[model samples]
Target: MSFVLGVISALTAPFLVVVGFIVWDNHWNGTAFALNMYNCTMTAIGFLIVSIVVRQFVLEPSTEEEIFTSQKIGGLMVSSTIGILIGDWVWLEGLRLLGSRKIIVVDSLKPFLAVFLGEVFLDERLERGAIIGLILTVLGVALVGLEKEDHNIETETTIECESVGAAGTEVFNEHTVLIEKDNNEQSSTVVVDSYAQQRKNRGKQSTKEFIYGLVMAILNVVLHTFGVLLTKKYGVGMTTFEINLIRFGFAGICMALLSFSLWSISNISSTTTSTTTTMTTMMTTMTMKPAWYLLPDASYSTWRRISFGVVFVSFLQPALTNYAMFQISLALLLTLESIGPLYSLPLSYILQGNRPTFRACIGAILAVIGIIVLSFKGITES
Candidate 1:
């Protein structure tokens, strides 16, 4: 059932994102207003569903890790998303001034960029093949993106899932376990501590969890790519925050009306949290990172500008992407995004489980190779 949901989500996600983007484009005229409205609306709907699910279903506190995850989901997450908007507004403004083509070209290096970020921020080692493959894939994806811009044909779609472990390490379930004794005969106690540290750094979630993480990661990449494309077409003048606000406004009205008419409405009004705020809170809580981490820092200007980046990353990105996929084609976008599996595979192994099987590794390698080939062939920007 979980796998089915994963597959369903993978299949539907890109279409939802593209459709959302298209609607957003129609409504907001490249301003943040459209994105905001869309975000708010979707968030309200999602929140209602989640509320119903939680209210109706099991609500057990499973373990210590789950407890930690829950704590992260609280107010800290919401504040962090607001921070992200502040930074994103600054970054988008820079991108606008810098121009779209350059921004996109820079954007093409996403996988490589992520790897670099991981190396710098988390001290993850960049493997020789991974680096080389990432470069090739980036080059290939760039070529494909360029081709897409020129020819404007739809892209293919695929889905890959990864699982995370408790210690934050990526574990690959597809591979056989390799047991190697330490050559540096350290004390057993120290060795145990080192192993524990390794796990913590890696983030070992469950297999199912790792897969979901991969899905979310792919969604992030796809949506950001679209954001770049949209920015190019509309120019940075479009306030994505406004788009989100409008989206949220409409979403709020709709959710309020619907909940009042059709569902059991909760008086979350006392919380004064909009659906966008709720989602921003939930997503940030899940990840345990500052929302501003996703955006660039611009000095405080208009309150809107200050909050723009955070709301976009935390709210608009998810909303537009969902709309895009909901109305448009999903296959191409998801297939392109599935290249995330390349990143997810190794990370899952290192974090969730041990290394992948020879076949799983080969599958991941081939996926990257295929992306490179596609890039060389060139894909449309749309």
Candidate 2:
């Protein structure tokens, strides 16, 4: 999903450039403001829907004391996500300094940063494979940027998954249990081989979670890319709030449809009160929360965060990221943008805290290398 978003962002870069040109030619600066505002509104709505679903369905009350603890944790989660918004704003600001291509390259390094952050903050350790993978990534990125020609470039999007294992760390919900004891007490003293297998499975699960992150990332990328084209053709006299409002609106509508489907199915099953119906109802309903409800609480401390979230989505991302195309070349922006994954990798691991097996380690390394190679267009040029 991340790779695909990268490609889509790249592919759509030209369209935005043209749009910016057209806007400029016609003196349509106001259009830009419209875009920015629209973008923010839509994104907020989408986020809200997703949040609602998570809170309503995905969560189970963890403990008696958790009601308050959960709110505290929720507060912290919102605070932390503000960091993401700040990171995103910085990313947009940096994009203005760089172009899409370079931004992508830099963003591609996100995994590396994520690893480093994971090590420092999350207690994630890098295996030999990860180190080697990082080297490959750097080499590959250099090669792609310095190279004169593209490699076996394929069209269309593809996604790959890598697991960071136990070394990775992330903030946790107190409600979520780390592990459950097995019924077989005789094997309480686990063997090394079983532990390894468990680690491998855990790593695989992390990969799945990353997929969700990638989905969100890609959607963000595509919307920003499209917004940039619009700005370049028109001009920045307009606010990004409009664009964000529109795009987010579309996203919100799509998510709303999803929510409706879930609700419809839930109501259908709610009519049945058998044990199986009850179980299914619980699972599905819990999972189908309106995404909006996922947002941080409306507490006074969170007001700034909520506002920033709104502005970043509605205005900054659409206008600034697109405006960046004019200042920095698209290639530079892309390079920088590639670093986003690096930012996420280790944190994801820490969040889940699963260890990587030797094989999984090797796979992760190779995958990172592949990602760099894909972003950089291979190492021959470098």
Q: Would you list the C-alpha lDDT of every candidate in the order shown?
A: 0.35, 0.36
What are the per-residue Cα lDDT tens digits for candidate 2 across 1-382? 4434444453344333322222222111122222233333455564455545655676664444323243433332332233222234444333323323344454455445444444454344544443554556554444432221111011111101111112210110100001112223322124223433444454565555545544444433443333333333333222233323333444444434545676577667667678887887678756553232122123554344434433433333334443343443333333333332332234334543433334334434554565444444411111
Q: Judged by lDDT against the true structure, how good is candidate 1?
A: 0.35
How high a TM-score does candidate 2 get?
0.32
Candidate 1: misplaced stretches above 4 Å? 1-12, 23-30, 51-61, 65-71, 74-84, 119-127, 148-382
How far residue 49's Cα lies from its native spot in candidate 2, in Å, is 19
After best superposition, candidate 2 residue 327: deviation in angstroms? 3.8
Best-fitting candidate, measured by TM-score?
1
